[model samples]
Target: MGNEETPESRERTDRTGWRGLLVDVTPLRTSPSFAKLWTGTSVAQIGAQITIVAVGLHVYDLTGSTLAVAFVALWALGPMILAGFVGGALADMFDRRTVALVTATVAWLSIGTMTLIAFLNVTQTWPYYVLAAINAASATILGATRGAILPRLLPTQLLPAAAALSGITMGLAITVGPAVAGVLVATVGFPWTYLLDAVLFAGAFLGILSLPPMTPEGGSASPGFSSVVESMRFLRNAPNVRATFIFDLIAMIFGTPRVVFPAAGALILGGGPVTVGVLTASFAAGALLSSLVSGPLGRVRRQGRAVTLAIAVFGLFTALFGVVLLVTGMMVGSAGPEGVNVPAVVLAGIALAGTGAADNVSAVFRTTILQAAAPDDVRGRMQGLFYVVVAGGPRIGDLLAGAVATAIALWAPALIGGLIIVALMLVLLRIARGFQHYDAFMPTP
Candidate 1:
């Protein structure tokens, strides 16, 4: 060929052999805007994870109860959900770039505040809770807006690839973030970790500011209660869309076990901050691995079936993770502050990784289905609903995980919740034929 490189040539050069299974970067190569956004967001995701894990560590230090730590996220849940709805309206009404930037600014400022508080060594817990809620709410708003912005930036054929790419960034971020946060906080203290997060947030600001204005054609309606209502009405008409949200909620609320990781480290796993970091990173690693080899995702047309099966796999693995915990504890017993249980930690990490991979696989299909099905005019609102499902579902899961762990055992909530997720998803899939047989190539709401 001439000096130019075609898509096929690039694929050949990138693949060479078995490495071809990794995440596709065609969207990043083709769309400069998308590329910039992805780069900036990925950097910021690592920072955000640092701050998140740090805050959890700080809260656990102050309260010494897993429920208290869970409540930290619980307090942020309602406001963040509302913010998601309002942000969706704003995205539809204004230049989506501006909306995204405004939210990112709010989150950045919140991080700054947290940094200051950490530096001061504040003993109070409520103020940190407030700041965390504010930060989470802002992030929720950004999530809805940024998700809506994606479809506008890339072609429809590349949407699946785009979602997989996102999974990669998120996977890497979560993997690096907690691991770094654990080490940094343990070594340098909370103030320094929070400061690093604040510093890293600049990348997000640059990314959103660099984006071109994204306003719908024909001048969309103003942001208001009516806009929210309009979105709700649309959802009423769309059963497949409704099913996706419900299924995700079921999975998160029932199967999520993150709220207990810190306690697991302290009480059962015995590696402390390092253990917490490794566990958190293990989940992200699973998700990352799945995204890395998601080349086949773009071709699958039965997206609904794919989503259901993937989520089912997630539940199974989650349950297995709980079993790992129970079995390990029964065999060797938990360790003390100076002790370690390497085998238990390794098995648990593998189980959590499986959970992450299955969840991302489901997410890839779910995202493609949502991006493909929703019309452009109402994409923001639709994305807002999605953000609610995403951000809010975890909070509910945290509450359930915390409560169940408190009542029974640290591992009981995961086992019970995972079983519930599997049963509920199976039932929902059977009855909701619209969601069960959804075809991607010929998509419908």
Candidate 2:
């Protein structure tokens, strides 16, 4: 072989060349405080997912209408949007840890109340909607506060890895949580499921309690209506941040296909409630797998490009989901009001899994960009906007998907929505070359 390296040697050298991929999770693993927070949040998230599944089932069992279950999000959307902006301001003005703690406590109480009402056989629709709205509003505040606190817990270089880990946690919660909820509702009943969620929510306290006091990063902004408006003005001047939010909104609004899931499960797929759980879990499954195998994600220099590409892939997969639905529909002829008999459910689940994986990759990059780029003083406000996009966009998608499915065929909404996402993303990417070439080594706002 003389002085030439053998193929095996070259392969080994190449494999080790991208060492940045091996994200040192030591900070998270070693920091007792962060570890407690992670553990508590993980448990709580699973609980929250369980409640989500339970609430949907409860509503559907009571009304037998997908629209009613969908309306739960609709009812919560206004409050959630308002809270996201206001909560962001709160995170900036107050101690983030305390804010998170209080909100989490309130949220837990809301669930506790829900469980109580459910056990009493209070089948009123208004109570469910009202309690769910309260729970959602509190969760929004907690989400914003927790997001702002993340940068403080770890080094800037590790933010992407942290984001990836968060995705994994979310994936785990949704993947296992809903399935567990289905079984619990089937066996132990909704009251017990809600009670379990209430109990599990106490775990969030553990996470919040472990954190040292984290004061606002910059001088506290006055907390009021103007503060929210001023934050909006600040974002208008910040083109890069604005672009990030805009792109995220577009991706979420057009690409999210979750609303049509129930109909898909019942009609296009033969497996009813079990199918619904599988379809939802499949999305999380893709996300979980992506995060687990994301060793190469940390090595990426152009995070913005990675984000754009990931979102684009997300749209493509969403389109594939629609196509699968369309094909199955064609194969099984319309069953009118009765429902179709086809094998599209499994195929749709697979497509959703792909979409979830792609979205997780985008989430990792987008969150890192926001945390790394925004000034600490304004990080809270920016994170608030991030929350709005993250929380609000999906609600909008739910409305859009629900309305479109009702007006047209169930599959038509996903088919058209997915195409819109792809087209819009391509145009946005072309216009924002700076975003495409954004290097993580030298951060920019």
Candidate 3:
């Protein structure tokens, strides 16, 4: 071979044998813009997770209700859903760099205000609700804009690898942020926690600022009701993309049991905020580990099949998590933080981590399918919808879990929801045969 290697031959070399079993770092090496964006966004996400966990704990501590904590998601749900469409349209209409910067600024301001409120000792929960809603909406928009920008920065073949790497970013954010928040909130108080988040969000500003101007390719549409309608019409014809959303909604709405973690830690598992943080981090730990070893994923041809199988495994693990909680509650009824059921916590952590890993796998494939199949002109809108499903589905789950746990038992929702997810996936496997056999080389949405 000559001293200068061809890009095509080098890519083939990157995917062979042992290298195929690890997360492909080619995207980062090939594109400096992508690297900077991923790095800054990852740092900011850790801070965002800090605020997320803190807010949930604060609400739970004040009201002592899982339902109360669930309402935090409810408060942001409407605005966030609306932002998904509006943000997508904006991304397509303007320079995505500008879109990301503006939305990131709004989100940063929201965090700063939260810090101010906490420092002022304003115990009023309404302000928290208002600010959280604003932040959520802004973040939803920012996520859509950033996602749309991904395809512009990297080659088409590298998108799957990029998605897998995102698992690492998510894993780090959720894993480290909650773990830190738990200790900080328990020791230093909420003001310091909020202040730290504000400082971290500044990194996101740098990432977005560094990006080159990225306007929609092919054509642009005005950000309006008509543009939103056009996107829905496209989705109606795009069965593959439609299926991705449906499966994700089922998995997130039913299988996600995050709402009950606060109560589980406080009452059953017995580690309080520290336990809550650890439990939450376990899920991300699974995702992080899975992403690290996701070398073979880039070579898979039937991405749809992979997505389905991964989600089914997620449901199984979610159910297992419920079983662990049930056994813990039965053995140590009404135990507090001082009790600390070590074995039960370990088992639950493993199960939640399993769910996280499986979910991340499905996310990687689903995102690739959406990015590869959708037309460039409408990619932002599609990504916007994806954000809503990815983000909003959990909020809906929080409502379901909170209500079900309050009405039935703490473990009932996960058990019932997990079973429901598995059954639905089976049904979907039969009906969505096209999706089940989706060819990566010949992507169709």
Best by lDDT: 3
Q: What is the C-alpha lDDT of each candidate?
A: 0.83, 0.81, 0.87
Off by over 4 Å in 3: 1-13, 16-18, 56-71, 117-124, 185-191, 262-275, 326-339, 403-408
In model 2, which regions exceed 4 Å deviation? 1-24, 60-68, 266-269, 335-344, 406-408
Q: What digit string (tens of lDDT, one per residue) describes model 1 on residues 1-445?
A: 1113347424533453465676778888867788888888998999999988898899999889877887787788888889888878888888889889988999999999999988888989998899999999898889888888887777666778889999998998877887799899999999999999988889887778777888854468456799988888988998887778888888899988987887788777788878887888788899999999987777677889899989988999899888877776666454443466888899899989999999999999888888778776777888888888887788778888989999998889888888887887788778877888898767788
Per-residue lDDT for 1-445 in model 3, tens only?
1113338426844576777788888778877788888989889999999999899988777778887887898898889989998999998888899999999999999999999988898877888889999999999999899888887787666778889999999889877887789889999999899999999998898788889988788889765799999899999999999989989999989987888998999888988877786788788899999999887888788999889889999999999999988888887765443678888899999998999899999999999999888877788899899888877888778889989999998998888899888888888778888999999878877
Give each prediction's root-mean-square deviation over alpha carbons.
4.2, 6.2, 3.8
The TM-score, computed over Cα atoms with residue i paired to residue i, of candidate 3 is: 0.89
Query: Better model by lDDT, 1 or 2?
Result: 1
lDDT of 3 at 28: 82
TM-score of 2: 0.88
Q: Is candidate 1 or candidate 3 better by lDDT?
A: 3
